[model samples]
Target: MKKYIKIARPDHWIKNFFIMPGVAIAFLLTEHSLKDINIFKLICAFFATCMIASANYVINEWLDAPFDKFHPTKKNRPVVTENMKFSVVIAEYIALIAVGVILSLLVDKLFLITSLVLLFMGFLYNVKPFRTKDIPYFDVLSESVNNMLRLMMGWFVVTDSSLPPSSILIGYWMAGAFLMATKRFAEYRMIGNPEVAGLYRRSFKLYTEKTLLASALFYSLISTFCLGVFLIKYRIEYLLCMPLVFLLFSYYVAMSFDPDSAVQRPEKLFKEKKLMLLVFVIIIAFMILTSVDLNFLHRLTSNSLVWVRLD
Candidate 1:
């Protein structure tokens, strides 16, 4: 059981939280109308996405076992620690993919398409021929595209209308891009050898700390600007929330520079007591303020429920 759990890398499952952005965006754009919320569909879609993402992680670990063995922290992973066998990993991967596809098909055609795209992307990330991580710009492009797809998946699940040109989507995309660049930057910094860095990620050779830092700053600024616009357009007055976002980004970047921090996985950052408390409080406050009345907080909640039916 321990081996299996380790193979699952439940710690990394936090990335599955990407589902929240989609659901949040849908709510922000529509207002929190329970009618259009389709709780059943949303729950299933979330689970399906998690399974598919888990499968990708399993496959990535299996394929990168050789390389991971040399990675300082990754060497402790189940696959490298020999806690889990390769054949077991492969079997679980197949099972996860099968479950993910079946659940997606049960939801709708759109979900099926999303699942297919995710599968293909996951394969490309590790497969020999078109290993996207081996290319320079393609690595970032692929990650960004995947994030866009995840957002679209959430958007389509709720509404049939074309996505509005809201600041929400822009903020999401920019935030995702910022994180992707930071991850690459961390990789480059941790592994001093240029060639080895390139072996792990093609983008490492193409990106310098200065370039990534500049890009991260740019994206963070864009995300903050878009978030403000989203608040204004929705008549949400909780602009104070902006500072929390800034703090989060700043802390994340600072952590990326620490060698000890590099040994920790990205998801673990969320588990920090202070950070988690701050995030939870901010989110709860936003939800309450937006959903309560016509105040800024209420307006924010109202926007999320735009597609919801009162009846």
Candidate 2:
């Protein structure tokens, strides 16, 4: 049972939390939005995404079983270690695919569409002739698209009224790009030897440390600027969170300098005290800013439905 659980890699599900940000963006605009949410359906949406992502992991592990033997950290993965039976992994993958698809079908049309796109993208990343995972920049770019799909899924899970603001989605995409780039950077640094890194991740063979860092910096700046636009267009007071955001991003960059930094596995943030506190503070500030109806913002932004989009 423990081996089975390990093979599922539930720890990676933390990435599925990306589904909530769009919901948060939409709810912050709606009156009595909390009451309007479908808690049960939202919960299902979360689990469905987790299952879909897990299924993808299964495919990856199965395909990489041979190559994983050469990877330093991945050498101990269940597939490589043979701690879990391949038959069991295949069974779980089938079950996950069924459950994930069925759950998505139970959601609304938009939610279903987003879920399918997420699944399709996941397949492209790991499997087939065009496996983006082995392609240098394309690997990260394809992986980042999952963020937009997750965000859209969340947006539809709560309400089918309309889309979240463009600025919000763009910011989220760039932010994901920033994180992906950082992961590549950490991989390059931690692996130390270029040849070793290539064995673990083929794309690393095409990336220099300088190129990866430059990509990370470029992505973070674009994400920050888009986020700034989002806040300004929605609530000017939200701009106060900028300092915290800057600090958090800086801390993340500093952490990436360490070969074994938790940044590589963002899910490990739960175990990071200082970073978690900073994130907590940021969340609290945003909650307070959005919980109330700020009249001026509605008046300031055009498209009337722009800020809260009450229409």
lDDT (C-alpha, whole model) for all candidates: 0.73, 0.83
Model 1: lDDT of residue 252: 76
Candidate 2 backbone collisions, by pair = 305-309
lDDT per residue (tens digit) for residues 1-311 in model 1: 57665666767766766766676677677755546678787777877887887888788877877777656567787777765666777888898989888888766687778877987898898778877866765666566566666776777667645663557767777887778777777767887777776565556767777887787788789888997888766645557577878887887787778775632365777656766777787788687766565455656667668857553
TM per prediction: 0.78, 0.89
List, residue by residue over 1-311, the lDDT tens digit for candidate 2.
77667766898898899898878877776553678788888888999899888888788888877767766687888778865667887898889989998888777888887877887887898887978999988888889888888998988887787888888788888888888999889878877889878887889889999999998888889889999998987787788788899898888888899868887777786788988899999999887876566667556555555656664
TM-score of 1: 0.78
Error of 1 at 48 (Å): 0.4
The residue-level lDDT of candidate 1 at 115 comes to 76
Best by TM-score: 2
- Name the regions of candidate 2 deviating beyond 4 angstroms: 83-88, 291-311
Best by lDDT: 2
